[model samples]
Target chain A: MTHPFGPATRLALVVLAAASLAACASTKPAGPVAPRGPAEPEAPYRPPSQPGPVTQEQAPGVTPGSVQDFVINAGELVYFDLDSYTLRADAKPVLDAQANWLRRWSAVRVRIEGNCDERGTREYNFALGARRSNAVKEYLVSRGIPASRIDTISYGKERPLDPGSNEEAWARNRNARTAITEGAR
Target chain B: MFRTKNLFSVLLAALATLLAAAPIAARADIVVNVDQGVTQPLPIAIPAFGGSSVGGQVSQVVTADLQRSGLFRPLDPNTFVQKRIDVNLQPQFDQWKQISAQALVTGQVTNDGDGRLRVDFRLWDVYAGEQLLGLQFTTTPENWRRLAHKIADAVYEKLTGEKGYFDTRVVFVAESGTKAKRIRRLAIMDQDGANPSYLTDGSYMVFTPRFSSNSQEITFMALRPTGASIYLLNIETGRQEALGHYPGMVFAPRFSPDGRKVAFSVEKAGNSDIYVMDLGSHATSRVTTDPAIDTSPSFSPDGSQMVFNSDRSGSPQIYVMNADGSGAHRISGGGGRYTAPVWSPDGKLIAFTKQEGGQFHIGVMNADGSGERILTSSYLDEGPTWAPNSRVIMFFRDSAGGGPRLWTVDVTGRVTAQAPYPLSASDPAWSPLLN
Candidate 1:
C-alpha cells in the first residue's frame, strides 16, 4: 500500500522524533564511556507525542459521547442508608453532576441499577432497591432530564458490590449505579 | 418423565394375604405425633428389598426420605436379626421384636417383562404382628426413584395420619459467581434433591421462583440492567413468556391457589403497590392503594384472603387483607421486622422471616398472627416455602462470609437439616403434590 502521510506531515513527525531524542540524550550522564558488558537490548519503541492540548472529543481512549466519558466525567454511583431508600445528602452532588452530563448528551439513554446489602430479606431488599433507583430517577427528572430517557432496575441483595459481611461493606453495597445503555459513541 | 401404573391386582393379592395371616389389628399402634414439641423418633427397620439391584436403590431412597423427615430412625441393615425377608411372605415378628424395631418395611422390585419395573412394598406393624399397608407400583426402570418416593409417602401417610410431602419438587435460584456480579438461574429438582436441572441460562439474574398448583408452571422475576420483568415458565414445555409490559419495575410474582391469577408488586417513582392479574382474562386489578411499600403477596388456600409484607405499619411487618383488597390490617405483633409472609398450603399458618438484633429467623404464626413460633435461627435465613402437606418448611440460610444453601425444618422445629444438594442456592419454592 502507498504511504498515507504527505511530505509535510512526515517532516513534522521527523521534527518531533528529533526533539524526543534530544530530551532523552539530555537526561544521560555526561561522563566517559565505561567498559560495557554484553550488548543490552534496545528500549521498546514509543510513538511520538503531540504537543497541543487535546479536546474532550479528541481524547485518546474515551470519546465525549461514550459510556466511559459519562462514567469518568460524571459520577455513576450514589450510596443509601441501611434499609432506607432516601438519598444521602452527599449523594445529591453526584446525582446533580449526572443530570448535567445527561443534558449535555441528550440522546443518551440510561438505566439506574439499585442494589442492597445482604442484611435484608430477598423480597424486601428488592423493593428497597427499586425505591432507591426510582429516587435517583426522580431526582434526575427534577433536574431537567426526561423521564422517558431513563429506566430502572433493582438487583436487591442479589448483587452486592462488597461481598464482605461487615457494616462497612454493607454500607458500600447499598447503593445505586447509573449505566448508559444506548445512544452512546 | 415416566408413567406410573398402579398394580391393583397385586395390591389385592397382598392385602388378602395380610388379612388372612394376622389376627391382630392391622393399624399401627406406634404413630408419630408430629405436633408435640418433643417426641422420640420411631425406630423402624428397612432392609434391602428383594429382587434386582434397582430394589436396593429404591429401598435406600425410601430410607433416606423417612430418615430426613426426623420422624423415623431407620435401623441399620446390619442390626436386623431377620434379614432377607421376602415381600410375598410375612416377616418373623419375634425376630423383629428382638431388635426393638417398632415397624418394618419390606419390598421387592421385579422386571415386568416389557422393559418396565414393578415395585411391591408392605409396611408392617411388628409389635402387632400385622401388615398396616401394602401396595404395588409399576413404571419404567428410570422411574424407580419416583416410585421409591411414592412408597415413602404412602408409609408416612399411613403412620402419621397426615398427607405426605415426598412426591413433590422444589424450584430455587441456583446462584453462582461472586457477590457483586452474581449470576442467578432458575433451577429445580426432586424433593429428595434428584434430577436437578437449570431452567434458565445465567445470562441475567433471576429470583423467587414459585410453583403453581399444577406443579408444571412457575412464575419468577428476571432482572436486567435496563429493567425488571415478571415471567411465566412451563417446566414441562420449556416455554417462557413475559407477563406483560409495565411502566415500572415489576417483581415478586406468585401464583394463586387455583393457578389462574398472579399477584405481584409494581414500583413507580419509588413506591411499590400490590397488583393481581387474572391469567385467563389478562385483566389486572390494583389490590392495595396504600402509599407505603406493599409487596410479597401470598394467597390463602381458599383464595379469599392474602398475606403480604408491607411497611405501612412504620416498619416491615406481615399484613392480611381481603382478596379484593378490603379490610386490611397488620398481623405481626413482634419486636423484629417481619417480611416474606407465605401462607401454608393447608391455610392454617403463615410463615415469615424475622430480622432482629442482627440475626435472622424462620418463624410461623397462626392465621390471625397469634401463637407465634420461631423454628430456625441463623446469620441469615429467609423465604420459607411450605410443602404440599404444609407439615414442612424449606428455606435458605446464608452463613457469615459464605454463600447461601437450602435448608428444611419441620413445623414443630423438631427436625432441621441441610438440603442434599451442596451448591449455593436460595429462594426455594416447593411445588404442590405432583399429579
Candidate 2:
C-alpha cells in the first residue's frame, strides 16, 4: 500500500507524538512537587492530588490579577439569575482563564464549590447547587480539561461569603468558586 | 427411679421460683393514663439540663427541641422559682406546678477524661411527681447537641405517650458556587437543621442522603466528574466509599431497615430501575425490572418489606415489595404525582410528597395505601420526613415569591410554623429518637 504524506503531515505527526510524550513524562512528576504551597497561605492551593490536565483563561469583566486574588483570598463568586442554573456569558471569560491556568499545571485539581442564595429550602437548595456545580464541570470539560482534575461541593447557602440582606449580597451569594490545589506539575 | 424422682423435684422448685417472680416483673410496667383523643401540644418544662463545665449550652438545645415540637409548651427558665438539675437532687414538684408545668426534664453532664462528654438525664412527670425514665450516655463535647436531642426524646416519650424524634439526624446535599459551575457538598445536621457540617466539598454531585437504620452511615448518590455512582458515607468519621461502578447514574438511595443493605435507583440509557446491594458483600440485585422510573425505595421497620415511588402505574405512585424483590404491589390509589415515600418508624404509616392539582402536599397513608390523609399543603412542598413518634412530620414548604421554608404538622393535619431561616432551605428529614 502506498501512502501520501506531505512534510506538513510529518511535522504535525512529530508535534503530536512530542505532545503525548510530554504528557507521559509529566504524569509522574506530581509525587515530589505535590506540596507546592499556594500563593495564599490561608486559602492555599490544595489542588486535587490526582493526575489530569489543567488550563486557565481570564474571564470577561474579571481583571487578570483580580481572579488570582479571588482564587487566593476570598474565592471567586459566580452569580445566577432567577430559576436559571446555566453560567452567564460574562462568567465564561473568567472560567476560561481559570481553565487555562488549570491546563498548564498537571497533578493539581480545583474544588468547585456550589452555592445558592437563601431562596429555596435546604434540600431544594441542595439539588440546585448540584445543578450549578454540574454546569461548571460541563464547561471545564468543554474546555478540554479532564473531569478527574475537578471536584465539586455545594454549600447550599450554609456558608455565605456575604452575610448581608440585600440584592447585591444575594447576587454575590449565588456563586461557585474554584480553589487551585498546591501540587502543580 | 430415685434419680428421676429427684430431677422432677428440682424442676418443680425452679418453676415455683419463676412463678413467685412473675408479678415483680409485671409491676415494673409503669402505667399512666394518656388520652389519645387530645391532639393539643403538651406543656412541659425542661430545666437547663445542667452539668456544663463552662456554660450549659446543651440545656438550651433541649429547651429548643421541646419548644419546636408544638406538643410541649416549654416553661420559661427565667420564671422558674427554683431549679434543681443534679440527677441525685430531687426536683421540687410544688415549685414546678406553680408554673403549670406538666412534665420536667433534668440532666447532669461531666466531661470524661478521654475527650468524651457524659450526660445523664431523667424525664419526670410533674403531675405524677415521679421519674418516668432515666437515660445515660457518653459522647464528645461536640456532640452535646445530640445529647440535648436525646433528652428531648426521653421527655417526649414520657409525656406524649409516643416515641420522641429529637434523637435523629438529617443527611442531605450541601451546595455553593454559581448556577453554571456550582459545587454540591454532602452535609449532615441535627434534625432541627442545626450544627450542619459538610462531609464532602462540591467536587461532585450528591443527592438523596438517607441515614442507615443504625444511624451511623449514610447512603446517597454522588456523581464524580469522571463517572456517576452512589456513595456510602459514615457520619462519625466522614469516610466515604463509592457504590456500584456502573455505566450510568445511580441515585435516590435509602438504607434497608436493618442497615445491612442499601436500595437505590440506577439509570442506564433513559430507563431507571431499583437495585439493592448488600453493604457487607457489595452484591447487588435488581428490585424492579420495569422500564419505568422506579426510585425512592424505603424499607419497613422489620426489614421484610420496602415501599418506593414508581411511575409504572402511569403517574408517580407508591409501591411495596418484599426484601428479595418479589410480590410487588401498588399501595397508592388513584391520585396525583407522589414521590419520596418514607415508611413510618412504627410500621403503620407511609409519609410521602403528594402533588395534586398543581400544588404539592405532604400526605400519609396506611401501608396498604388506604386512608390517605394529607398533612401539609403549599405552593411548593416536598420532602416529608416523619418524627420518631409517627405523629408529626417536618418538611420544607416554599412560600409564594419567598424562599423555601421549613414547617411541621401533626398527623391529623394541623400546621405549626417553625422558625424560618434567612435563606432558602428545603428537604427536612427528621432524625430518629436520640437516646
lDDT of each: 0.86, 0.65
Chain A TM-score, structure 1: 0.71
Supply DockQ values for each candidate: 0.38, 0.03
Interface RMSD of each: 5.5, 10.6
Query: For residues B255-287, could you state the per-residue lDDT of candidate 1 as single tens digits?
Result: 999999999999878789999999988799999
Interface root-mean-square deviation of model 2 in angstroms is 10.6
- Tell me what TM-score chain B of candidate 2 gets against the true chain B: 0.80
Q: In model 1, what lDDT does residue B247 have?
A: 68
Candidate 2 runs further than 4 Å off: A1-185, B1-39, B49-56, B83-92, B106-123, B128-143, B177-182, B224-227, B399-407, B419-435
Candidate 1 segments exceeding 4 Å error: A1-26, A32-65, B1-26
Summed over model 1, clashes come to 0
Best by DockQ: 1
Worst 10 residues of 2 chain B by lDDT: B13-22
